[model samples]
Target: MTTASDDQKLASWRAFLLTYNTIMRRMEQEMQDEQDLPLTWYDILAHLDSAHRGALRMQELAESVLLSRSGLTRLVDRMERAGLVERHPCEEDRRGTYAVITNRGEETLFQAMPGHINSINQHFLQYLDVFDAQALLRVLTKVLEGERPAEGSQAEVIEGDQ
Candidate 1:
């Protein structure tokens, strides 16, 4: 039988999942209505736009966008067909491939930015005060860092790091 603490933790997890889903759905609808862009496509474009030379290796892009390799491959194929991105063979490694954002992709990203920011502000950020935002960020960062493997930790490791 689950104890009271376990029950409370489960409830909290469920609440977090529900809130995440609700916010994502609202943001997706807002983007679809206002910008005609899906959140997933925007996420991929945003990552590419921020990367050096507006490009990233396929594996890195998959990790950045939290998609499986096969899933990312299919999505990239679609984006390429849509004229939003292009695939370039890596000069360093013949086997490696890079996804480079096209001029059209950059234009689309710029066009979608305002609506995305507005949706975020309206659906999420408006609810947070400075302190709440900071606390939430800190807690989420800690959780994410903790989830990383010690061998390949993403956060910096100090002398006394756990």
Candidate 2:
């Protein structure tokens, strides 16, 4: 019962998955070599660093990271022990908590950004001209808008927006 268009779309999705995995692997390897941080940890730190007040509620962090509650809790435990982040009680809700980026985390992310950019350029951007990059960005924006809630910006995640 499948149409040719559906087959083509499936193929495109597969290709996108393969390319994304390959690029992520390369970026992860480079990040490990240059900064000794896992891609997930870096992702968390980057999100926190860019968040309003350099912090986010635990649930917001989990959603932004695309991680489960328990997974984020464990990740934050490790990060906290490493002095990269700290947890604070939410002002409005006693039972709630926020993950705040520590000075060390900020410094680490600042240091890692250049290498991350270079890896992005080497693995993906270098192959694309400006026009291609712009077009790709437009397409990606569409995809992101489909997946992201209205409140979350590409650069920062804020509460009460969605």
Candidate 3:
């Protein structure tokens, strides 16, 4: 039992997936070519920079960056060697480690930010009119808040409130 609305919804979902993959690849390639830095590294640096006192617990960072704990640990090891980040044993919680951004990390992020902003503007923002932008934001916010795309759907959206 196919319906026009269901077909349209599936088409929209496909479009979203395609656009996301395309934009991410472009962002990654541009970052690597221009800065000699991987997009994953940039993402970690940016997340760390935004955290309180430029630090976050390893688990929190893993969640923030959408990386598994083991994966993040390996990446953080590399970053530490590069002087981009440092791991400090938490005073209050000895078992927890905090990933803190270094001055060098901030410098790197600051340098990369302008190009990133330009890329986002060029590839994404320019396509959205004000109304479209607002609508997009609202819909995304709702989705992030565990909203169902269709009424009567019982699916759960898994997202942490960061």
Q: Please report the candidate that would top TM-score against the real structure.
A: 1
| Residues 49-80 of candidate 3: C-alpha lDDT, one tens digit per residue | 87889999999999878899999999999999
Q: Candidate 1 at residue 135, lDDT?
A: 82
Ranked by lDDT from best down, the candidates are 1, 2, 3
lDDT of candidate 2 over 73-151, digit per residue (tens): 9999999999999999998999999999999999989999899888888988788998987777676666776677574
Ten-residue stretch with the least lDDT total in model 1 = 153-162
Error of 1 at 13 (Å): 0.6
TM-score of 2: 0.83
For every candidate in turn, the CA RMSD to the true structure comes to: 4.3, 4.0, 4.8
Instruction: Give the worst 10-residue stretch by lDDT in candidate 2.
Output: 153-162
- Computed on alpha carbons, the lDDT of every model, listed in order, comes to 0.89, 0.87, 0.87
Better by lDDT, candidate 2 or 1: 1
TM-scores for the candidates: 0.89, 0.83, 0.88
Query: For candidate 2, what is the lDDT?
Result: 0.87
Off by over 4 Å in 2: 1-4, 144-162
Give the Å shift of residue 116 in candidate 3: 0.6
How does model 1 score by TM-score? 0.89
